[model samples]
Target: MEYREVELPACKSIALIAHDNRKASLVAWCARHREALAQHRLCATGTSGALVAEDTGLVIERLVSGPLGGDQQVGALIAEGKVDLLIFFWDPFEPMPHDPDVKALLRIAAVWNIPVACNESSADFIVASPLFAGRSQRMVPDYERYTASRSAR
Candidate 1:
């Protein structure tokens, strides 16, 4: 496996997400953490972004709704190294129509070695960590080498 070091800047690009049932909690959390979160760039699916933005007054780049490929859009951002962290307030109990897309987004985050907060507690830990406002090194996929190896076969 190939790997490379990627640095997450002091000001990060964070993604916010929440299932419909948990949207309220996510919005509340955004409000509570507004001071800390305000220093970073934020993005989220359409409805979630709007709610969080309304509550926290923080600007967020809105993508399509998750069921309408928003998760994939976020995954694309992660893949392209545009997003540094993912704050997903997912409801574990729900069976979503776009379950595969959600999984794909989480999987891509893991592949990219970005910090992903699946719940409020996890989000708290990530935000409270020193790396939130400083550089943190993570190993990312060396896709170029992988592609070259595949092409040689």
Candidate 2:
């Protein structure tokens, strides 16, 4: 597939997601980074969003519950280039009924070439990076080129 560069604005649109078992940890992490995170646009799956907002007092756009299609919502936003970063704290030990949705969300984040942090350590590193607070470029699939090539076949 062909690729092209896209810019991520300094004030990025960040998506947060956390499994039931990891919600507390995610909330704590958010609280720790509250000051830094306040500068960005934040969204999350329902319960996690509420918890984070309550604990950190940071505004968050809440979507449906994860099992109720929140993961897909975030994935769609990522695909549309509306989300610049993903901070998902999923539990590896527990089995989720909507596991396919979780996998698909992660897959789409990779496809869109967005920065993703699946755990607190990675999230901390990403937040601490210079790129996180400044404009940055990322290579993504050149969809128009791929479509044109396919149409010419």
Locate the minimum summed-lDDT window of 10 residues in model 1: 1-10
lDDT tens readout by residue for model 2, 33-61: 99999999999999999999999999999
User: Which portions of model 1 show Cα errors greater than 4 Å?
Assistant: none
In Å, residue 124's CA in model 1 sits off its true spot by: 0.4
TM values, all candidates: 0.97, 0.98
lDDT of candidate 1?
A: 0.93
How many clashing pairs per prediction, in order?
0, 0
For each candidate, the alpha-carbon lDDT, in order, equals 0.93, 0.97
Residue 11 displacement (Å), model 2: 0.3
What does the lDDT come to for candidate 2? 0.97
